[model samples]
Target: MALTSIKTSGDKIEIVNQLLLPHTTEFIEIDTIEQAHDAIKSMKIRGAPAIASLAALTVASHLSRALQADPAPEWLSSPQLLDPYITAQLDFLYTARPTAVNLGAATRRLKHTLRTGVEQGKDASAIAQDLIQEGREIDAEDVSRNKRMSKWGGEWLIEQVKAKGKSPESLNVMTVCNTGSLATSGYGTALGLITYLHETRKLSRAFFTQSTPYHQGSRLTALELLTLKIPATMLCDSMVGSLFQHNDIHAVVVGADRIARNGDTANKVGTYNAAVLASRHNIPFIVVAPVSTVDLDIADGTAIPIEQRPALEARLVRGAVYPFTLNAQGVKEQATVMVTPEDLEGVYNPSFDVTPAELISAIVTEKGVAVKADGASGFDLSSIV
Candidate 1:
């Protein structure tokens, strides 16, 4: 069975608690916009695309219930009353996570819908319905477009290999973090490209980093590849350089949290390290993501916000106790153990890092692949976005 991060039934949304993943499968219901915001802020529901989907769905669910209320809420009385209420909700949701541009894009898109409906002179109820549809579409469109970008990236990589006078079959690809079924609404971004290669029988093996602190790659990506029955190898984040130095890695594929207009990509922390090493090793580095991740307003990576997680998060690791400790519920007991000294004062834990456009071989979106022009340091992503 495929692993899912977000699941929806009618207006109710539930997400798999990612913190307890690979051991426990807990589905927490998101009943309100506040709950959705909290989930994203706390990292219970994460990944740029998945959190964006949740935020948009929460808005749709909120408006849906408002319409069905026995006596409609005061905010729904008219467009004048509705406009500020919905706008405020979206603004608050955007504050939950500052680094991922996808969340901001989703909110901005909804705000546009609201403004367009009002300008068209639609009544409150009609405008509410339009907003609801648009919100749902934001989530619904993710999966299909992910598959499209995956195909584009995968085929491009194969052709690049073939052009170099190498057999395209049995290519070994390395990836960072956890872009898989559990990261987005469906397929994925980088992991989707890896899956595409495997599906087309062009893959030999997939290598992934442990991605410390959160260990999303070890905990989430590992489980995902195992479920899909793909041949994979897990390496410590520190080993990316060694892996690249010794292995015939065809490419390093990663997903973007935010992609600047110059093609600079902010992704999980270790992604930059992999990109650097891949460049030294002459391996292609690919960034796969949806169009929503592209932030054209951000001229360069320096303008991109990097989220800092709690220092305590870096001091501890959560997992099932080895040697098989079982809890009363018959499941393996999971605990958070402090890996660093109790009095540890400093822990630099930034959630993501940016890879310069010069290090990137290609940036693939649902629209198409964008590459740097001859003698260019960055990509002109305006056309692709």
Candidate 2:
């Protein structure tokens, strides 16, 4: 029951509609660049890496189709004409989700490939082929890197426990949001490390927060863990502190949307709250993600741009009607109900929050694990990136 967020066949692309997860599985086709943009922006296909993959694959599909057209498109006539057209497409894709650094990284990488190919005197068709290959590679590389970082983070946690004169066996862990197979190409980020621990027989039970407004935790991560047959418990977003207080939780692991140069991490909205509580409970707080998530250009967390979701999104909840409302198809009848007052004037719905480097015990990437220098308040991630 390995769940895939995106699926592809040659130049055709499709993504699972994550909004209906845990209850329903629906695959929606992504045929055009605009469709890709809408899917990412609408959270039809989310998670930073997942959206980046969709964006890259969509670009590849577009170029591959253009190359096979009966009457060649005007933009494909020459590199001079091709450069701006492709550039505009990349720019448009970047605007789909502004907060995810991975999307920007993918687009920037493609632009560099395009520039280098043109400078090497490649023809427009050759350049198109090069761009297409690079885009596909961007999606293909996510799973392997995820596996590497999961091992790195999992082993680091075990060592940290042993150093504290505590048994590392059967460690209880808590996670903030969904970071399993449904969130990436495969494996995962933080959830991958939890899986690594379980696979190695070191995990007792995994706890996850029911991330409010999006329920990514209860819906997506819960499904992933159950599919893998891992023992897990679900708690409300408000229960993280209580879970830490009553449970011998070894660590709080989470996935990041973006990481600043000084090691500040931006993740799901409730992550900062979990980090603060973990710090108070003396629990290790780890950020697991690929290197592409790090943005060296941003000096600190304050500079990270937070995308605020629509106010209406915070006021509505979608789920199967209680008491088992089943349709003729045998699937539960789902509906979106207004949870807040119909005319509620004030609703705060920022999609992410930044956790200061001081609160984070370590950051793990495919390269390795990074910790702050002795007596330092922040990490200089210059080498890690």
Candidate 3:
């Protein structure tokens, strides 16, 4: 069976506890806007698209509960009160993760729906219903668009190889971090492209980096590939340069947390390293993302805020203990072991790194594939976004 990051049944929303993933499958229900915000902030649920879906759905569920209350909530009594309450909740959710722009986009979309409904002279109940519908739409739209971008990116990579006088069949691709369904509402961004190739019988094998610190690649991506029965190999982050030196990696595809107008991308921290190595090896470096990830407000990557993780997160590692210890619940017992000395000072752990547009060969979205001009260093994404 395929894995999903978030699951919904009617108005109830639940997310897998990613911290104990691969070894344990635990789903935590999100009952309110506060629960959604806390899930994003605590890294219990992540990925740009997944984060946006959870927030939007939580809002819908919150309002749904309010509508069924014995006495309608004060906020639901009037559009005037509903506006501030919903706006404040959306703002709080946006602040939970500052770097990924998708959450901001989702919140803004809900706010827009609320504003438009009110301006149309709709009653409080009607406006709330409109917001609820918009929120559900936000989550429902993710899967279709993800599949679209995946095909665009996957086909583009094939053509780029053909132009180089190489057979496009059975190409080897490298990716970093976790970009599969576990990271998104459905399909994926970068990993989805890899899946596209696999489904089309154009993939040789998928190579992934361990993505140190969080180890999303080793833990999450590895599990997803294994579950799908896709042939894959796991390598350490530092070994990317060495892998390029020896292996025939045709492309390095990555997903973005934020993409500046110039096509400068901020993604998982180790992505820049892979891009640089790909450049040295003459491998194509492609970025696969949705149009919403493009922040037209920002002219360059420098303007994109990079989130810094807690120092303790970098100092510790989590996994099921070796020698096969199983708890009474019949699941492998997981533990967090400290990899460094207690209270280690100066642990530099930025969750993401920005890769310049010059290093990117192509940026694929649902709209189309974008590449730099003949002599251009950056992308004119205005056309694509």
Top model number, lDDT: 1
Ranking by lDDT: 1, 2, 3
**What tens-digit string does per-residue lDDT give for candidate 1 at 237-261?**
9999999878899999999999999
TM-score to true structure, per model = 0.99, 0.98, 0.99
Candidate 1's displacement at residue 143, Å, is 0.8
Worst ten in a row by lDDT for model 3? 339-348
Per-residue CA lDDT of model 2 for 193-229, tens digit only, reads 9999999999999999999889999989999999999
lDDT of 3 by residue, 1-385 (tens): 6699999998899999888888998999999888999999998998998999999999999998888898888889888999999999999999999999999999999999999988999989999899899999999998888899999999998998999999989899999999989989888999999999999999999999999899999999999999988899999999999999998989999999999999999999999999988999899999999998999999999999999999999999999999879999899988999999886798999999999999999999889999999999999986678
Against the unseen true structure, what C-alpha lDDT does each candidate score? 0.94, 0.94, 0.93
**True-vs-predicted CA distance for residue 121, candidate 2, Å:** 2.1
Write down the lDDT that model 2 would get: 0.94
Residue pairs with clashing backbones, model 1: none
Count the clashes in each prediction.
Answer: 0, 0, 0
The segments of candidate 3 whose C-alpha lies over 4 angstroms from its true place after superposition are none
